[model samples]
Target: MPGEYGYPNLNDNDWIWGGTLTDIETTLTHGIRWEGSDATRVNYMPAFDGMFDAGQVAALTSHVLSLSGKAKPNATGAVLFTENCAACHGATGAGLPAMGAPALNDAIWLYGGSEAAVRKQILAPRHGVMPGWKDRLDPATIKMLAAYVHSRGGGQQAAPAAEPATDVAQAPMAETDG
Candidate 1:
């Protein structure tokens, strides 16, 4: 009777209901009646069990490897960052904590360091809540923002990539005393 709750087959006492219940009764035998009709009627399958094929696994692994190193700056990416992200995240991707910005250079990611994770973050910024600490602590006792940012395990400063030679004018040099 419990299985009659909103189940179309059970509502109409259809053949499917009788067949399924019979099958379950035969399989579970003595336990079926006391266990309730719902128990015997449920058909469960995991959301992701064996979802990915071998090709998908290989592609995902390769994508992860690609994001581990410094991201190659394409002109479009550079322009997009400058216009949208440079104000908060520095031009070099160093995060500014005053604005609650997080460093993109680091391998240590709060949510996840995967390429997919990064893409999701860019698509939707995280909005976390914290209690007001201004009334609880003195300004001098507040922790250094830079140190906190560094403790998050930011990536090492990567050297600039070499560029192909192009025509350039030589600048007049001013000698400086040591």
Candidate 2:
């Protein structure tokens, strides 16, 4: 259920952008890489066609497959993964939600999970686009849609807000001795 055609399968818990209500609403409003909207959720994985040779591409592909335990791990692939793919996809291929990178360590994949499919993607990355409903649909409709999607079993809670940093220099003096 992870891969639905070329797009991500919503039936599962793996969320590329996010599964929270707010996150879902934002995606529904702006869309993913939709050119029609300025606020589209955009993240592009660069094609390694010209960047690396065929051997290197194969190594990278092998590495990706190995992440999900689909193939045997290779030293060449590990080195390539560390040097090239670790920034966004993460060192362990766990993925970074803020960067819109999917977890490669898991069996889930946006596209097909075959070795050939992985190789093709690494060679010439395929980017999917979702249309924004702000221009066509009313705000109420969008909100309702978001709610519906959030009700699905895969929905996730929003991340907690970061704690505010304390200003050590602004500490108040204690009056206990007075």
Candidate 3:
């Protein structure tokens, strides 16, 4: 809402990933689609323009909207969803954390959640990317930021103590500059 690629508010319980401190910490260390870290997370929802016809996409949008009870469930959409979306969004539309799919049943949307918006997303999905903070902040600082995020009340239980941020090893230097 803040910008073209702005992230959602942190205070909400709707986490793309899980809400655990470790989970948030992991996300912070290696952002979504971030190329900076070896452990960086990435999930891509391919556009459906080539995959489905316009009518199918509209029907799929109808089904997705129906997951939240916003629209009547059309057989066409439901069938498409069952065959396609259910794997990641789940049979009940409860999104999978591992797959980075947001729950469609929930009204909370990172992007606009209108029917048209849904259809557009089906046609050309948005692969939201979150930048990693490892290069910008030290491990301890990252943990502190995590703690602050935890204080926002959406945070889950903390995981066991683990090392932070410095997952990748330095690349070997090549003798080039003379």
Candidate 4:
């Protein structure tokens, strides 16, 4: 009979004694004589267990290096937008505020000023509600709508001029409604 360990079972009489000779021999040879039994157990050696190989490590290192400082987009303005922005902001960037879209052309920015900030906004889509213009307007109407918006300066603009220090110091107070 085959033992659970797959070694053939040997009767005691098969060896020098009547006891199960294979088990006795194994116990004596490994457990007692040389302590080879514990060493032969698969779980005893962790190095043999495969996890991350050399190629995988190298690939991971290369990926990390590649991502370092190379993620900034080269595309900007309409080109940057049409390829990336228009889907949410509308072709003209009029913004679908009802869809949480803020008009990009307007001076108002929910986040803040700076190209970096705008880039962040472009990378992450904001969720909001808006009436589906598709349902309300036909394709030709939508096209005309986009054309009208584009005519009204639909792209990004140059950086705003800096305010003179004196102007900044004497800036008028904004009116407040009571």
Candidate 5:
């Protein structure tokens, strides 16, 4: 189960970053928000304590719950979510793997799924940090770890390769982490 101690579940498809072999390798090498590694995958969801009032937070929480069919939908919550969360979580709350954002439309949640849990998270989000193992483990060991993790039931297939451009004038855009 996820959120047992702020760590994600490796056995489920609701990956916060991604579930590919390469993605797992990268995460194990640099870690997620690890202070020791400059290449650590990092992204922060700003705390909304000061940004929203009690009622507003409740509305937003309800809206988030509604995404997973756990609560009644709130129009104000929808607007608030669009204005504040769409950039990273996507317009439909599907999430962006590149941005390390978790999908909210699914029933799978990193944290608890209750109304109170959602409200607390809305007020003050918690960000988990995973330490990099590159310094502590050899490349082969890391590869093995990646392999083991990839064998989990939730592991995803590698993304399809992009087609090469025939036009020299057209160059592939560089993708950057958020």
Candidate 6:
């Protein structure tokens, strides 16, 4: 599914992946966790069912829900979140893009944002995957698509032009190696 996952606009620099044109191109060509791209990206949040007790999960959910001011702060939940989730999702739940985590402080979510939805996710994590287009599109065409995407309003400024290096000799590689 090419769903935007409720993320902010792509052209405005809010990227789980980097926002450079090359970064966007790589994402499009390889896809995330899809079999087609030789270098597909893949990361997943672990399900915390057995990892945390019901009480702890409840607390974390409370703290996370409270981030959007949807729930009142619960000391137990706040403590649990600080100890367990602060690593990937900043202490304030701002989310660390390098770890493929999304901000929880904001209402935006890949999954629904209700308490029930949040709890279910904690108990059973879900990961979204994008299929790669390299197998279906030529590099030239893919570059064209990237250009169009980069032209969007959310697109960040392109990196300064670098000296064109001689094309590194390379040969076509197999897909799905491993």
On lDDT, the candidate that comes out on top is: 5
lDDT of each: 0.35, 0.78, 0.74, 0.32, 0.79, 0.70
Model 1: residues with Cα > 4 Å off, grouped in runs: 1-70, 133-178
lDDT of 5 at 3: 46
Residues 1-178 of candidate 5 have per-residue lDDT tens digits of 3346578888777778778888899999999999989999998888888998888898889998898898898999988987887667766677677678888888777777889888877788988889999999998899899889888768888768733212211221222211
lDDT per residue, candidate 3, 55-95, as tens digits? 88888988889888898989998878877776666666766
Choose 3 or 4, whichever is better by lDDT: 3
TM-score of each predicted structure versus truth: 0.37, 0.85, 0.83, 0.26, 0.86, 0.74
Q: Which model is ahead, 2 or 5, in terms of lDDT?
A: 5
Of 2 and 4, the candidate ahead on lDDT is 2
* Candidate 5 positional error at 66, Å: 0.2
Error of 6 at 45 (Å): 0.6
TM-score of 5: 0.86
lDDT by residue for model 6 (62-168), tens: 88999889999989887787666666565677665545567787756778789998998889988777788899999999899888877774665555773221111
Q: TM-score winner between 2 and 3, please give it.
A: 2
Candidate 5: what lDDT? 0.79
Error of 4 at 140 (Å): 41
How many clashing pairs per prediction, in order?
0, 0, 0, 4, 0, 4
Please report how far candidate 3 places residue 36 from its true position, in Å: 0.8
Tell me the lDDT of candidate 6: 0.70
Cα displacement (angstroms), candidate 2, residue 13, comes to 0.5
